[model samples]
Target: MSNVVVQPTGITAADVLAVARGTAKVVLDPATVAAMATSRAIVDRIEAAGRPVYGVSTGFGALANTFVAPERRAELQHALIRSHAAGVGAPMPREVVRAMMLLRVRSLALGRSGVRPLLAEALVDLLNHDVTPWVPEHGSLGASGDLAPLAHCALVLLGEGWVLGPAGERVPAAEALRGAGLTPVALAAKEGLALINGTDGMLGMLLLAIHDAAHLFTMADVTAALAIEAMLGSERPFLPELHAIRPHPGQAVSAANIHRLLQHSAVMDSHRDDLAHAVQDAYSMRCAPQVAGAARDTLAFVEQVAARELVSVVDNPVVLPDGRVESTGNFHGAPLGFAADFLAIAAAEVGAIAERRVDRLLDVTRSRDLPAFLSPDAGVNSGLMIAQYTAAGIVAENRRLAAPASVDSLPTSGMQEDHVSMGWAATRKLRTVLDNLTSLLAVELLAAVRGLQLRAPLTPSPAGRAAVAALRDAAGEPGPDVFLAPVMEAAREVVRDPALRTAIEREVGTLG
Candidate 1:
């Protein structure tokens, strides 16, 4: 990967992923340095005038009235970081920490946080050298800008906390810095607050979730198409004219994808004129587009939110270009919180509808002529019966997880920072919801492919056949009874696999 130059605008989700994965390097633009210098001058002028700024000369939170002497200004910054790095819980994933570091650096580079260019450089060096700080998962109320978690990150820059070395071993920050040929950065006025006061943690997770949801939403349509064909369902409902009348962009995209995936399908053509077949299929088959399309639309809205946030400068006591320092509440995480919560609900509904299709495929009565549980022999082998159970279990949990985290706020910071946005919690659970949705869709794919295989002599559509062939190659074709766990896991891998989608897209063009 090449170096990604940090600009005040145009940083993308892919860039964050690349930097987090250690495949890309970050370089600060000269204009960004110039901007930071201008902001730093304002901060310095403010300090020189001896007037109290929220985080410059005065204490923070409930103690904002307390003033510090000029001699202890640096000491105040140091103490703030130390006291705030008090989070508890398991260490956050390495990618999350790296993303947080990158986002913090990006926000500072925008020149609104009043930090020196060297501070931003230190953050970039941390990423380039693969030194990830051990940030905890808890202690952020999503107000006052992920204070505890970010302070832990700042601790590594100060050479005062633990860091994961390039070799993936936990080591002291001092040791890691020395081995990487770097040194600790000393805190200056407002530098500590600049380092810790932003919504980087929540925003990073939200971005990752948005990226994953985009893929999964498209995958949902693909899996639903496979299920529709497997159950011998008709594609008339997906006709262009039928959907054009109620044209929601997402619904139209989904209906078109299903239409394309089911084209030239012998099984569907065989039942097109048959009077014995039910006139209309169940809602699970007919309404797949409506449910999945709503999710696609939700994802589009969430992406917009994430895009706006990517270019925003979130900080407390932001420095103005006119040499004036003012306190602001841009650090609140409500925007991200609401978006995360909405996506979780949308993802859960997608999984719910997919689970319903899985149920239709497994039930012998509802599955047209397919065997019970899609098994070769019903009672002897419990083929995929429990798979639906697993999918159902996951969907149930997703429903619970979908409850909005933003609605439950608890006061923090001595009641000075009340009405916090539990966005960290929201995004954290959103990851789980996405993971569960992947598995749920995989179960649906497994059942549908088995149904299609049973439909044997009659061929499925080109795209559906390609998906089944890819799955069979990866996980082997389903049979009577065998070890179910590995097979199901392999199927899940195929469902989550980008290559499967790529192969199908090559055959029938790209899906929605």
Candidate 2:
């Protein structure tokens, strides 16, 4: 089971992933609760003194300088949530929405947002009841936080918008909130900004995408091992001694992963004695560790960013216990925005090489001892030909998306909101790359496993065979080209399953 440790004031990306995977729970650290109390006391004192504050007595965003009539301030707060809930696009996946909810609530819990403990508690209640706000995917500037999207999240507190009720029924926000015995929260000073500002929505999704992409990196190694041994590719490139002299961690990790896959394999035995099938084979095979290691390095950098940020108090007008309000740039997402784009490039390369190997697996001229297309009929069936085509297309699309969204920024907020990161765009693209790469690897997994199927009853690498068996059990042998789309998706599920991967690793040992 997955779980997250909510320390007195810390939230980890792993914690979010655990809750996302249905393996754990989230609770406030006792210290965070105290911080909330302290901040709320400061806010109450300020409001009681009738001193005009930013969010408490003023408008937000474009209307920042406009003052809200004191008598109508509460009404303005409610209206802000409703008016800003203008997001349009397909609704985000339920898991992402759940993550957004937790992130937003946790951000507010730091007490810096000036929301009442009851408000934070209600968010917890909503999440516990499994009532997630149906937030739209588009409409974030990646600045002033993820305003429009989070407005959808805050809508649940207002008894507006749609929610996934405990019974799994989609119901009105009011019904879901009331049924859960939670009340709408009234935003206090900076509460509205705190509720909506920050990179929670994008960060949550990117964090999960990043974690999964890391797993995909390993899967790429396992699948690549099959292509290597089948093609009689040399394993000398992965020797630990080779990497030790250069000393790149990602390169080392990729080399290690391959070593794990090739352990106990007979296919590599003939590579030296056979006098060469096609000389040295393609760079994708010979340089798999090197190319893929660069990707691992990129992932490592991205992980560092997420690991550092998830526990940070990202929402702004961050509270100071001494009653000083210092506005800062904590809300900016340039760091994560750039990280998202970087990892997409890494993931794309991971897919790009896997696609090359799939091409190799399908070509009779290249795939030693294997039938054309890994199918008996070859010319008549076309077997895995189009699968390679599909992979190529997805890889190209990934290339286009890999252009950093963080590098290009459009000025907003009348130049006040200038220097936008568009980090949300980067994170969103990273997610798409993840999906694309999953299917790309799946196609290869299908072709490789199919190749392994022919060797059936013969044997695969101790680890490779088990990996193939797990897919075969779940997806069955690819007898005839029926509906392959489902098979591709199913194969992806097998690749994503951690247990199958662990079994392969245990049998094969470490890569390098």
Candidate 3:
């Protein structure tokens, strides 16, 4: 793909992903550069006149009243970056740092942060050359932007911190800059604050999580369909007419996906006329759409929040086109915080429901005659009983993680930043929840596919068969249990594999 030309108002979630994944390059639009120069001129006029600006001549936060001499103005910007670059713990993933860099550049390119075009271009150069800063996972309260984390990012531009080279080795920022044929730029008035004061860290993680969650939501439906067919459950509950009366768009989409996946199934037809079969399946089977669909709807709302954030100027002291510099609470991360926490709740519930289905599939009593844990050699081999335990453990952890981090706030910066969003913490945990959900769904898919394989001469729907075939191709057929960890891990990989979804789609067409 060609480099993504970032216009002030047109950065999308996809653009962020492309840059994060290293598939596309980024360039600031010429018009954006011109606007930024205009903003920078306003800052220079203010500084030259020795007029007090919040982040220019005056101190930050509670220190806003303190005045500084003209000679010390550049030192103030540099000091702010060095003092705030105090994040601790393990570094954030390289992809996340790349997204943060891309977003910070995008925010500056909007022409409201009063940063020179050179600073913004330097950020773009860092990304384009693949020199990722090693930002720690902690330090931001998510109130005054992702201060510490973003400072770690800005440290690299000043040739002070460490960066991951293109070959994935850690090197000094100076070395990385020299290798990339780039030089560090000096910080001007309010430029350091502009770089660090925003919700870019949390927002970056949120965007990436949103992207992954979109796919996982669909994968949840696909795996649930396999479980339903594997257990001989009726597809009648998923019929469009049955869902039309309720009329939730997400529910309807999920139901339609399930219906399509089970079309013309010999396994389902075999039980169609049996009165001895239970009149209806359990909630895990019958209510799969309701649970998974709620997640889908939650994702849609999160996407809307993310989309608005993409175009927003989240700086602290924003420079307006009319030349007014105002200190505002636009830097607070409450918006992203709430969205991340909300999505974590939705994701945990999705995994919880999938775990229940996995439990049912393993229990001989509840599974409608599938062998205990799908084990042909019952007593001698434990089969997939432990896999349910693993999923259950992860589901329990997810429940704990679902508690809203946004609600837990503590005072900082001498009570000036007393109420923080804790949004960075929220988004961090959301990434974990997503990872757990992926593994949990993989476990459910593995057990369900095994149950389907045991069903023998009765064929699943063409879509269902295609899904099973995809899993078998990736992990081989399930049989008398051997070392199952490798198989389960392989199954997890298959769940994440796009090809598996594509193969199923070729048979049943597109799913929701």
Model 2 local distance difference test score: 0.77
lDDT of 3: 0.90
Of candidates 3 and 1, the better by lDDT: 3
Q: Which model scores highest in TM-score?
A: 3
Write down the worst ten-residue block by lDDT for model 2: 1-10
lDDT, candidate 3, 436-511, per-residue tens: 9999999999888888888988888886687687677555665666777887788888888788788888878887
Better model by TM-score: candidate 1 vs candidate 2: 1
lDDT of 2 by residue, 343-434 (tens): 99889888999999999988888887778887766666767778788999998998998888888888876787877778888898899999
Worst 10 residues of 3 by lDDT: 472-481
What is candidate 3's TM-score against the reference?
A: 0.98
Q: Return the clash pairs for model 2, or none.
A: 2-23, 145-198, 256-511, 256-512, 257-511, 259-511, 260-510, 260-511
Which residue pairs clash within candidate 1?
Answer: none
Error of 2 at 285 (Å): 0.3
* Runs of candidate 3 exceeding 4 Å displacement: 165-169
lDDT of 1 by residue, 11-76 (tens): 788888888765899999889888998899898988999998889999999999999999999999
